[model samples]
Target: MREEKDARIIKREILPYLAPGIAKLLWGKDDKFFAGLEEIRLRIKSPLILKIGDRDYTINRRGEITTRLDDAYVVEGEDIYRSIASISDNSLYAFEEDIKKGFITIPGGHRVGLAGQVVYKGNNICILKNFSSICFRVAREIKGCAKGLLPYLIDKNGQIVNTLLISPPRCGKTTILRDLARMIADGIHIPFPHNVVIIDERSEIAGCYQGVPQLEVGVRTDVLDACPKALGMMMAIRSLSPEVIVTDEIGREEDIASIYECINAGVAVIATVHARNIEELERRVLFKELLKSKSFGRGVVLSRRQGPGTVEAVYRWDD
Candidate 1:
């Protein structure tokens, strides 16, 4: 109870700081969402905790995530706990199912979230289930995202030809990739654009929903969701035979190995890694496989001063 109260206070304090896009999402420019959410507060029962735009409230029941739709969730069933209704059945399976499927849309369009046991096989995540808290980090789309870095990358062909973008944490590597993918797939005046295969490890790119992409990427792009980079690269090489391979945040042992093979196979690679500066990045052992001290390929560095996805610097290999 004490913890929940603390969280509520935090929620209120942070409400004013939501991102521009996210603020529009939950509350809308007219504040309709905010008002709608407020009215829904009256319906929540016990055991269900609700955190909307500026405040946090709790439900009186366990299945409140679904029941508290006006503000946060849209309930799927009766107020009574179905799993516990059977007397002998104590498992909260029914309630858990709704929680997994429902989304937590916070005020800034940022969403915090919860889930059940993350089912996995080897490195593959099969599914997520059960439920507790939910948080959506918030989603934003930047236009002309890669325009700043194009000059350093594009060649006589007008296309980047071959290049890599590097960044640390939320520096916008993926955003650049998304714009580049869209631009490339559309066959920008930049010469012959070829097919692109995106190994989206986290369904963020192209955000395919109902078989369609929630995010705007070019038409010629194909994506593999949740698969590791190496396996996806190998698959693209064989099946898609793409002209270029693009992916985000690469630096694993397997990632280095796969990229090396891709380079050897004569496939151009566009990838990013979490590094502050090239000097700082070279220290990482995995990079040795892709970048040699002076003979490294071109790279784009991102930093806050440069802007959210600002291009800090570009490096070209001695080769």
Candidate 2:
């Protein structure tokens, strides 16, 4: 189902950016390599590593299994150059802003993590130059992954509820957020579709390529790709008239204020934050006021105990 779509992204969207030798190695490894692949790490003169599930494996130049540091292919500077060229479509200036963000979203919603020297203009990061590494993160859309969680986010009136998804890094908060957007926007089991606006500050949620979402968010979803969450949320409320505004990883003070504004305007928000559990989330200084007010009606905590997206517990605010 949805798993098959992600596999195609790797081949059609991601493979073209890879250097010839590395791509060939990955291709020769079999479909399992692509199926299980989560990340591909390429560093200058370093081992070519692939993250599969929770484990990492080093592959040699010939795509053979290799653990020895010396046996692994030493990624060169040219490999990075070619990758940047392919990801940016030979127009690096067009993606200059994304480069400053430390990543670029290519054609298939996949993100390429950039690393190199920081060029600063005053206190702000102007750009990243002399790139030495590229980490490919595969974008996956589990169509019905959020189906089990949707019931908790709805009331008897069939209206969407304000919810927050809490999870630590690499715990699939963005993935769940993306799926939820699709369901809410397209009206999975709901009687009517809710207008969903996604504030994709990192371009990870919607994976917009050239302003068009590469991932299937939904027919009704509106995405403010690569826009700051605070500004984007305000913009969505002011213009898009969304019933549910979805965004990832909200923690900053401005983000909190924007959420309040959205709620005040009668818009439900579904956002993610970094916390192990509700207790940890409440303890944080930035989240204290928001938690105290119970602005968010429901909170879902995720953990890696049973792997990413494992819903450990659900908390409801009694208001």
Candidate 3:
């Protein structure tokens, strides 16, 4: 029943943005395809692609991906428009801000990546036009992924530690972050729950739809969905009195500065950054201040060597 429910959610949230023919083609596929489906890529004049697990397949017009050119389905501009209308619910103006960011979060926490011409005004992106491509990244929550890291994130007193997750893109940084947030909020591996404020800049961590989180973050977690990390961190600190502040993909100078402030305020932080390993993390000029200050007492590195969310190594500041 749970699996069926998940499938229904995906179909309802994602299929509307697809052209009728393409939608029918995808819906007609075997259940196995949807079981591990990760992303759907649509490019104008190019083949329709599906990313399932770690493999990519090009879907044909007949609802099958094959080696023969005749079997491959080519995407069209009309498909793009139909998808845009579907995603925006026919009101593109309402999502102008998200479009400028090159992505929009549909219901069920699904994210649609957009690409096309960019319109800028005074060094800021004002609009996106002439859409040519779309990538729908399906969101999944693996509840136990954070269990392995719980030992490292908690101390003897049952207090959450100041931790930072490091990984390259597609290494499941956000996935682990989401899981940890749940664990922290639920008091898993700890004596009692802590107040956790999530600065969910991309809405990926909490998957908020209409201001409500679609994913299970935990009973004690408060999410600032789609809010900038830097600003949200400050806001969480000032108002939430959080014992732990959680966020994903921290790279900006302002973000680091805010983390410093949070640490000084005695709030433990769990955050992620883009880096292959400890050495690379230390070498980055932007991260130098935080690294030198030892703001993050513990570090967890992730990779796809085994699979997404694979824990390569865990480090302590004194290590």
Candidate 4:
């Protein structure tokens, strides 16, 4: 059943964006290979690479994994062009804004990261051209992943405390945050449901594609996809009247101010940041004031020591 699901994901979500021959080659691989798949990298004039778990492997022309560089399948420029065409639906101009942002979020919440010549309009990036490499980062939803953290996040009054999730990249912080949104919206482990709003700056938390979430974020959740975090939080407060606001990777000065506004509005907040531990988070100039003010009632540290989403420690600021 797992293999079948994995195959279906690769077929529906991944293969369509690959070149025809390359897609056929990948489809021939065993289902188990797709099960642990995390990323697929396509580079012009380079070997096809796959990142599974913590290790990287090269794919040969025969659809087999090999360590020998000479045995690997060399990706051609045509493959890159064809994949880009497919990803953009043959209209690259239509995705100009997304391209400028360096990635395109496809259906199933998969993010295709682009690399090549950067086009500049004045001081800001105008667009990307001469595409040379693309990375497909798979987004997987794990329901009930936040169960263990419920006790730490929820207060005795049955309301969620202002919380911050700290983790390094690829530690499943986004995955855990997604599940936390769902559980909070659905009233899981809580007394009643709350109107939860997700400020998805990168479209990672809700995995929203074309303004609709591809992942399950509960029946009552509202997502503001691709909006700036600080702006989105204020917008949600004014229009959505959300009881709780969730966002990922909040570190900017404006983000801190907006979080303060949310607190003043009597809305709970759940946000994530990139940090290996509390000490590292404190060393940052921006977060110092937030920590001193005790804006977050609880802080959860996550790591990949056991696996992705592993909870390392939970700190109570009020203590």
Candidate 5:
């Protein structure tokens, strides 16, 4: 039943934005196939590819997975154009700003990455044109995924601790962060519900589309979609008065400055970074400084040994 629901979600949320022929090709795939689907890539004059886990598989015209490149369906320029049109609601101009950023967040919180000719305005990007490749990254909401980490994130006083989640790319850092936000905001294992704010720089945490979250972040959560981390943290502090601020992929110096500001304001912060382990994180100058400051009360390391979001270890920094 879960697989069936996942398949339905993909069909309803992601397929419509794809080219008609491509959508038709994927529509007939079995529920189990869709349940494990992670990403879909379409490149002009290239074979259509589907990513499941860490492996990529080519798809044939008959909606079946194939190992032969010759049997795989080749994407075309027309398909790319149609897909762009569908995703943009036929008004590509309206999404020009997002397109300029190389991706757009669709209704289901799924992100479609675009790559093509870069139109430059002086030193900055003006727009993207003549799309050649589109990668659809499916977003899945795995509620309660962060349940085990709650003990490490909460203190004896029931207050949420300043936590950092460390993981490499595609290891479910965002997914875990999302679930943590939900659990903390909803007071799942804490004393009571608290105001949670998500600084969604890339719209990946809450997967907000048009100022509303498409995923289940929580009732007490407020999201700042597509906003810079530093600016969003200040905004949440000044306006939202969040008790807990959640953000992903924080390593920039400016981000560190904002984290200190959050700490001074007595707001708990839950953030993630791309690091294989604590040793790797400590090796980086910025992260080393962060560790020296002792800003994070706890650190949780994740990996893909068992699967994405596999918690390898949790460390209490204050200890």
Candidate 6:
């Protein structure tokens, strides 16, 4: 009964802020609780838990869960709900699964992440049990973020320009990379002419939910999601016949070797790394290789001014 009341309260309170399609569903009963945007997302992942305190929780690809709290309220069906008073409802955030650098394996591998407070215990940071709010960044795909970055990648001599895109947090760096793959795959008429192969270690870039791209990556991009960068790169070379290899977040031994492999094969590469500037990239041993090898031809760096998801700046590594 209390849960039902909470659900009703949420519907009454939240509908005003939701988009029209979602607001309509929240108002309807049978259809409301079933197909409404909120339920639609929850139905995709059973036993969904929305944190109402301050903390983080994670469910792995193998269905193993590790959370700081011993208990969490689960939302199973219509009559279930919980309420948090005076919490900001429009804040944007990502699910907890993203921290693992992986998406959730919900029944169909649909992922969910929880975000809130970080409780630290002397070198150990854990999520708090009192979550005042949560951020749900649905892992959907927009296939054209990379379209603008491709031309710069192709050099004047009919070869793809070596490029790097760097950005802090959510500046659409990955989104751009995804589109670049599509353009390359579609036989981008850049100076460097080659089909593109995407090495997507995390499901983020391609949003590969079911061994297929959730975003439109053009007709030519071939995506290898959920594999380590190194292995994925080699796989692209040995099997995919790619002229260009792209990936997100490099600076690992395994990843460096794969970058070397791509260059050795005379393939143009585009990838992103986490750094404020060329200096931070050097802090990581993996990045030092980039400086020494001069392997990556271009670099893009991003900054988030106020918070995550806010796009701030795009820096060129090659420049």
Best by TM-score: 5
> What Cα-based lDDT does every candidate model obtain?
0.57, 0.87, 0.87, 0.92, 0.93, 0.54
- Model 5: per-residue lDDT, tens digit, 48-135? 9999888888888777897688899999999999999999999999998899889999998999999999999899999999899999
Which candidate model has the greater TM-score, 1 or 5? 5
TM-score of each: 0.63, 0.95, 0.95, 0.97, 0.98, 0.59
| Residues 9-70, model 6: lDDT tens digits | 44554444333432343354432232212212232123333232222443222333336323
Predict model 1's lDDT versus the native. Answer: 0.57
lDDT of each residue in 1-319, candidate 1, tens digit only = 4334433433453333333222223332223323323212112132333334334643322323233434543222232223112211344354343233343233322333444357767886554644322333434445577765655656655644456677777677887888888777777645667688888765566654333455677778888755678899999988998777888888789887788777777777788788888777878776754576332368888876644687888877734
Relative to the unseen true structure, what is the C-alpha lDDT of residue 119 in candidate 6, on a scale of 0 to 100? 66
Q: Which tens-of-lDDT digit does each residue in 1-319 have in candidate 4?
A: 7767877897899898998878888887788888888998999998888898898888787877876678898999999999999999999999998998899999999999999999887899988999999999988888889988887888888899999999999999999999989998998988888999999999898888899999999888999999999999999999998999999999899999999999999999999999999999999988978998998899999999998999999999977
With a 3 Å backbone cut-off (N, CA, C), the pairs that clash in candidate 3 are none
Q: Whose lDDT is higher: candidate 2's or candidate 6's? A: 2
After the best TM-score superposition of candidate 5, give how far the Cα of residue 237 lies from its true spot, in angstroms: 0.6
Q: Which stretches of candidate 4 lie over 4 Å from their true place?
A: none
Error of 3 at 205 (Å): 0.7
Better of 2 and 5 by lDDT: 5
- Candidate 3 vs. true structure, TM-score: 0.95
In model 1, where do residues sit more than 4 Å from their true spots? 1-130, 157-159, 293-296
Q: Point out the higher-scoring one by lDDT: 2 or 3.
A: 2
Q: Better model by TM-score, 1 or 3?
A: 3
List clash counts for every candidate, in order: 28, 0, 0, 0, 0, 31
Over the stretch 1-319, how does candidate 2's per-residue lDDT look in tens digits? 3445556668788888998777777765656667778899989978888888888888876668665767887888888888889888899999898899999888878899999999999999999999989999988877788889989998778888889999898888888899999988998867789999999999999899888998888899999999999999999999999999999999899999999999999999999999988888889988988988988889999987897899998888844
TM-score of 6: 0.59
Order the numbered candidates by TM-score, best leading: 5, 4, 2, 3, 1, 6
lDDT of 5 at 71: 91
